[model samples]
Target: MITDNTGGLPRYCHPYHGGWDVATIALNIPESRILFICPVTCARNICLNAINGGYKDRVDVLALTEDDIVSGSYEEKTVAAACEILDTVQPRPKAMILYVSCIDAMLGNDHSFQTEEIMSCYPDVTCFVLKMCPITRFSGDLPLVALQHDMYAPLPEEPVPHTDTVGFIGSNIALHPDNELIRILQDAGYRPLHIQACDRYEDYLAIRSAKVNLCLMPFGKTAGELLAERYGAKMIPYFARPDFTSIRTTITAVCNALDIALPDLDAMEAETVRILQECAAYIGDTELVIDSTATLFPDILRKTLTACGFRIRRIYADGVQQKAPDIDAGSIQMPLVRSYEDNENVIAIGMAASSFAGADKTVNMFYDNGEWGHYALRMLAARIRAAYEHPRSAVQVRKEARK
Candidate 1:
């Protein structure tokens, strides 16, 4: 059931998508401070989001004025602001992100020159400039893509080698802590590098040491490229293309590049089957509603879940259309929904879908994040188990998701 909007564009999309986007992810970076240098008006939503996500203190805004815009001294002012932040903030910031808004897009200011001043002044705080122009979404970098690149901006020009380290780049959150991906890497004698796994500048700097990068989500593809260019590591992009058989192939490719032995694929497949059996037993007849944002490929994951004996009611996304027709899957696409009052006995994945579906149970699978491989299965099963204890209101679910 598609709700028609006046324009051809879908109501729920990037820039206006209901849940959190890259800006939140950027602010949540470890050992980093983000100073958003833009209009004060840009402050409210980001601040509210920061508060809700429990990281309000990590972000600050340097509101540029109309006079500054007209005088074209925004760049100079931005440099000064960085210096000020360095002097005032105790312990100093390891890195500062100078986020310029779309209003200043036309200025076409060369940010690096301005940032050089900040670097020269403080010589301690590592900073980079990021353009936050929504208008450039179609033409250039969206904040998500740009943040992925900037996150790696701190990589050292001359990296030290740590052959046993493996980096997981480009997912919003790190993979599930207990994920077999970690087990697989460990069994093969490689350590995993997740941003959150590091607390100090030195540990974070060691991101440069990974022998290979696994781009689990689409957003990470460019980050993987940047890492490859800087560290000469191989890039293996899964990019949310969900299919365990295909994913295993990609993992094999990554292992070959590192000269590490591949994990036991047959055992991996059996473990996945065992979890799905548990999901099927618990799910029973509960309708499973998927939102594209919940997994890298909703359709691909839909196929996988159905094979595990879950019932898919509907999906709140356009992704199913991109794949070849599967008569057996019988999946249908619906636009962003308003209510799912009729579907109470549901297991909803993705915040938007869970909000709309009003499922009795919901998983915190916001925009796929690192929900790939068996970790995806683990997270899904865990959500189902949690719902058995306390169910959430669809109204509460959707409203909280709007941030």
Candidate 2:
């Protein structure tokens, strides 16, 4: 577990030390149009999430099968099939992202060679390879996924002049409310030098010109450290939530770093309090049970729910011991359970695991959408209310119960 300055929850660490292969490839691909070729078994979710996050039209996905794994013929055949698909599709992508699974890594498959062969045959397209290790099975967390993406992205070409530019890094979470940060920065009269999101790599060489680096999330540690050492840029790491108080603190920190006058703290606090109160009213009386195998959102959910006046009855989270101190600080204490037991009155807040566990009512907040996780939190609340007003059908209840 890595602890931040605040002594809260620890940051989650990546499973494999060698770094994530697919994240690197995703970050570096220069072409606007992309294709994600994933190993059939383990990387399906990766491909699906990338596609769902607005990469749908620009990216095509192909899942590799077991026969390919057993025979060692998957590499050539898969590439060829992708090329054929591109040929028939008419408007082919500018580049292809070849994502290897744990099977490929364990089998000692060389994705670089396969990528080169495909690029050579196509001539007009570029290909990059990313190897995804089975982090969950081996080490329990996939923080390296974001890091690998950062690694493969091209470093910024030239440094912006150090006079007034700022860099925003490590904002891969789909629900990251960056608009608030942007508004705060604009109000503070600071012009952003650069803004890098998931898989958006800038040339490190040019990043030093910025006076400071504002790291929105922990994943940007690598880039932030590098910039600090090389370009003398100050790294201001901040954890953002939907609450306005957190936003105000973030703005104050940024202003302090730039030697700008602090904004009106009283007004900011008042506004934040009002917003939180309103949100609480909207979600008051709702009961929620958050379950996460990844452990990325338990604390986040706790804080958000608390702000919105939702009662969290229980949390099914793994990797609590490994999280960074700052992350765990705000985490609420709920009975940790491995499975849903007696969760009749509570609505589940996570992926669709409740359905399999036989929960009467379940809500899936996390779903694979190409590049980001879509927020269905509000939708889940609506459904819960509807279920309270009008119960589910017996047939439908039985169907879900069987799973």
Candidate 3:
């Protein structure tokens, strides 16, 4: 979580980086294989991530040599590597995610050509050309965003007959069974589909039959739009935020999109409030800390927790656009760097925060775990209380958060 004060390459900490990596996300497609074509230096860490992520069996590496790049033979080599995997790998993959590193981007490799060649050779296999290029991190379309879009791009463009099914895009973890959104849809006789819910490639392709596509995160918005345009479904993006007002707005939008009567949220809001108050009372004056590793918007989370009567002592994030001064009024905003002593009284919300503070009381929440609306608030409170009552070491918390 170190801030890059020097404009050079940013530093990466393994333990602090939670949630699924690009390899894991790519492999989410059923019966999929990842062929990462990059120089030896770049492939090492990605291969390690895939191995550590418990998906090494599905991932193969094609290490690029200096001659391959200099002689412009890397493109052909990449296709050959993918074809070799398709031929030799037992029970051929239904889908293949072909990855290229920053070097390929710099050399202007034509990925479309490679994709066409692969598909032409193996018509049964779906091939997606994905970039591992981190040089475009600040660009509008980062690798993760592109991956989300491409993963679903393989879905048929031809219209499928509409069904009561609704698709939820962009969450690595499936929404909780008791989540308000799931409950509402199920009660209304509509089936909800998420990538995590699919056991087979056919189950995933059924997303085209959905009348509406709900995007759970901002990164999945592009994929939702693609589904809507290609399959003629309504695209509804309710990027999850823990705050009550935001949750209400999301619920209203979803109801309007579905043309269903809005469910009363007052009771839900009250339950969330009650839970928060209980947790806060138990937590007392313990110093609470947050970090970006746990969530995309640490400042927004800080504001939500502060408004819920929990006094957040500090926030560790690389960069935060202070939305409001009052929410961050007394809380210290520090860079995501590990530079603190162990403190039993300090409760940390994220792995990075716990690692930095060395706090025993740590809540292991990563990327919100697909939680949203009032349900998210209640779950957060429950986690906070649990962390306080049964303190765990930062290492144990971090390990659980990653899984």
- Model 3: lowest-lDDT 10 consecutive positions: 327-336
- lDDT sort, best first: 3, 1, 2
Clashing pairs in 1: none
Tens-digit lDDT track of model 3 for 281-353: 8888886888776766677777777777888877766545344544332222333344556655788987777
Across 10-90, the per-residue lDDT of candidate 1 in tens digits comes to: 444422234365466665456677778788987678777777777766777888888888887777777777777788887
Could you tell me the TM-score of candidate 3? 0.89
The models' CA-based lDDT, in order, is 0.70, 0.50, 0.78
In model 1, which regions exceed 4 Å deviation? 1-7, 13-20, 27-29, 322-343, 400-402
Candidate 2 TM-score over all chains jointly: 0.59
Question: How many clashes in each candidate?
Answer: 0, 36, 0
Better of 1 and 3 by TM-score: 3
CA RMSD (A), model 1: 3.9
lDDT of 2 by residue, 19-57 (tens): 123432354333334445456545454444455444445
Off by over 4 Å in 3: 1-14, 318-321, 326-338, 395-403
